[model samples]
Each structure stands twice: as structure tokens, then as C-alpha cells.
Target: MEAVQFSPPLGYVFDPTDCELVGFYLCNKIANKPVPGIDYSIPQYDLYGSEEPWQIWNFFKQRLGEERDDQDLYFFTQLKKKTSKGSRIDCSVGTGTWQGEDGGREIVNDNMRVGTKKRFRYENKDSDQHGGWIMHEYSLDQHSDYVVCRIRKSEPALKKNKRGKCQEVDSEKKKKRSKVQEVDSEPLPLAVPPATSRTAPTTTMVQQQIQLEDETRGF
Candidate 1:
């Protein structure tokens, strides 16, 4: 029998609500305060650099060893003006550009507007092809120059049946147990009937039946 190989657990998930992103992360970042789990969760990066969207994706995907294609990436990026004298911000990549889809959306926390989030789509420089990549740029209301951005592939390259983290863990455990059972060569021991026993059920049998009934009720 072959030993089953188990993969490592799917690490922390970085999903945060819009309010949390603005009130906690964006605010802390602007204030130069320590943000918990920022290094592993949302790292600082040059989002508007020369690298294309796909190139950035491959780099991080390899570095992080993330198997899921549907996960979103969060980053702290500084916005740069188009020119030294111009007030417009540049959103161009190497050969692609991030075209804004909307003006801006207010991100409110505790009935107070904390920041603005705007959506962008990556488009090729010389072609009409677009929408393979998406980004949500978040900036503080007071400090709009520097912002936090969330990037994600609009459509996943690899598509599979959706499963939760708990489901994946349970599946791995079941596979390990099955492999162990197969490797064990010990013979089963036969159970002997009690002396002078009739058709009456044992206390253990009643307890197991009751437990099964309780489990069935859950469904």
C-alpha cells in the first residue's frame, strides 16, 4: 500500500469588509501606525510600475504559492501624477492601462465617509481587448495621493467546483484515514454473542442508535 501525501493547509484568508478596509487598514497606513497582519495579508507594492497585470499576477502567485485563481490581492500603492505639473494621476502599465469604469464611490464607516473606491479595468495599449483584469482603488478622503488597491482577475483561468476550507480539510482527513486502513493488514476479530442472550438490544446498541437519530435530525 502507498502512503497518502497530504498538502499543507490553505493559509489565512484576507477578505475584509469595505468598512474595515477603510477605517482600520487605510487609516492605520496613513497614520504610520502598525497594522496587524499587514505583511502577510496586504503587502506594500508598486502597483503602477512597469510590470503588466498578468506578470504581476504570476509573480505573486509563484511567490505566495496560492493555488486558488479566484483570490483577490490587496496592496498599498502610491499614486503618481501623470506629469510634474499635471494634477491627473497616471494609471498606465508597461503596454496596458487601467481604465476607470466609474468616477468614485464613497466608502462610509460608522455613518462617516472615510474614503473613495473606484473600479478599473486593464486594457491593452494598442487593442480593444480588455476586462481580463480588474482593480479597486481605495484612497483616504484626506490623503488621496497614496492609496490601497485591491486587484483580482475578472475571470479565473482555472475553474472548478467551489469548496470551503473546512470541506477541503475534511476531505484530506478522510483520504488519510482510508489510506491507513488499506495499509493495515491485521485481521478483524469476531464478536461472540453473550451467554443465554435473547433478542434484546444492548445498552451500547441503544446509545449508538440514539446518536444516529440525533445526527439524522440535523439534516
Candidate 2:
């Protein structure tokens, strides 16, 4: 499949919930389903053994033309494995190595473990500035056979209090629904003249003339 770019929505950022990431986006990707009205979105790409973090960031920024103020980046990628039966992430990618921040965090769906989210910091061999680069690795269940990762700058403030920002989008959606209901329920009044003055009385009887044996009777 061709790589489709994902542009953030106007006046909002792309911060999907854990449930949405697993249930909606990843499920549809696994099913090869196309999302409507979304021409460009997180492209399906394998990042494990690909270019370095900076290269990946630059490539996406060129495609996006503008960086999201939120600075959180997302991608849909297939997990890299050491062997068909082995369970290890192949660490050989570009110039530097990817290091996990903490032990993987369990991302739950419907009270069941669906995937693991791991934070990574890129340590570039040539420069110390690369240490600030961060990536979020969201690997699905072993049965899923696929993964989606989010890349971003290392900022502790952005990660904290993120759920509150997500709620803003929800509130906007509710307001839209209310506006639609109000327009639908409000009746439209049409100008109508009074019925008695506007309408003429109908003629119920007509004079009739009958001739029988040269005699005529009128009632």
C-alpha cells in the first residue's frame, strides 16, 4: 500500500485515547479498512530497522508542512522480530540505538491487555542534542502481529494533563449535536389567512325544473 500522510485536524490536535488507538485505528488498519474524509493520516511504515529519529522527523515535517504544537507524532508500523518464533525487538536501525525509558506500560482495552506502550530516547553517536528526541512504541498483542508507534519531542509538561485537552474535542462534538437537535425540533411557522374570511361558502342546493305529462313541479 502507498504511504498516506496524516494531517492533524484544524483547531485541534491528534491525541487519540488508548481505547481509540487499539479499537478504532489499529483494528481498522489490521482489517485494511479505509477511514472516510481522512485523505492523509499516519502512514503504515516499519521504523525498527529504518532511518534514524531525526530523519524520520524531518521526513514527516516536510510532508506535514507545519509542526503540531502538541508535538506528539504517531505512525502505524509492523513490529520487527529477531526470528519468526523469537520474541525480541531488532535493535540495529540507523546510526544510533533506541533505549527504552521504563519497563513497558500495559495499554488495556475493555479491561484486557491489548498492547504495551514503551518510551524510547534516541542517543545519537555524533551529537548530544539527539538525546532530547523521544519516541512512543505501542506494540500490539502478540496475536495482533502489528504495532503503531508515536514519536515526539521530550517534554514532561506535554505528557502531563493530556487527558484534559482530549476532553475539549469531546465537548465540541456535544455542542454540535445539540445545535442539530435544536434546528430539527424547532417548528417553522407559515403565514396563513383566517379560514372563515379567506374561504367562500360552497353552494349545496341548485334549482331544478322537471316536466311530466305537460305538468311542472318545483320544490
Best by TM-score: 1
Clashes of each: 0, 4
lDDT string, candidate 1, 47-154, tens digits: 888987877777776666787878888878899898999999999875888989999999987788888999998877343235578899998889989888888986
Model 1's TM-score against the true structure: 0.64
**Which residue pairs in model 2 clash with each other?**
5-40, 5-41, 6-40, 6-41
Error of 2 at 203 (Å): 99
Model 2 lowest lDDT segment of ten:
205-214
Cα lDDT of model 2 by residue, 45-104, tens digit: 667765766667777766666565346667887766788899887654477777778888
Q: Model 2: runs farther than 4 Å from truth? A: 1-12, 37-39, 142-144, 155-219
lDDT of all the models against the reference? 0.78, 0.67
Q: Judged by lDDT against the true structure, how good is candidate 2?
A: 0.67
Worst 10 residues of 1 by lDDT: 156-165
Best by lDDT: 1
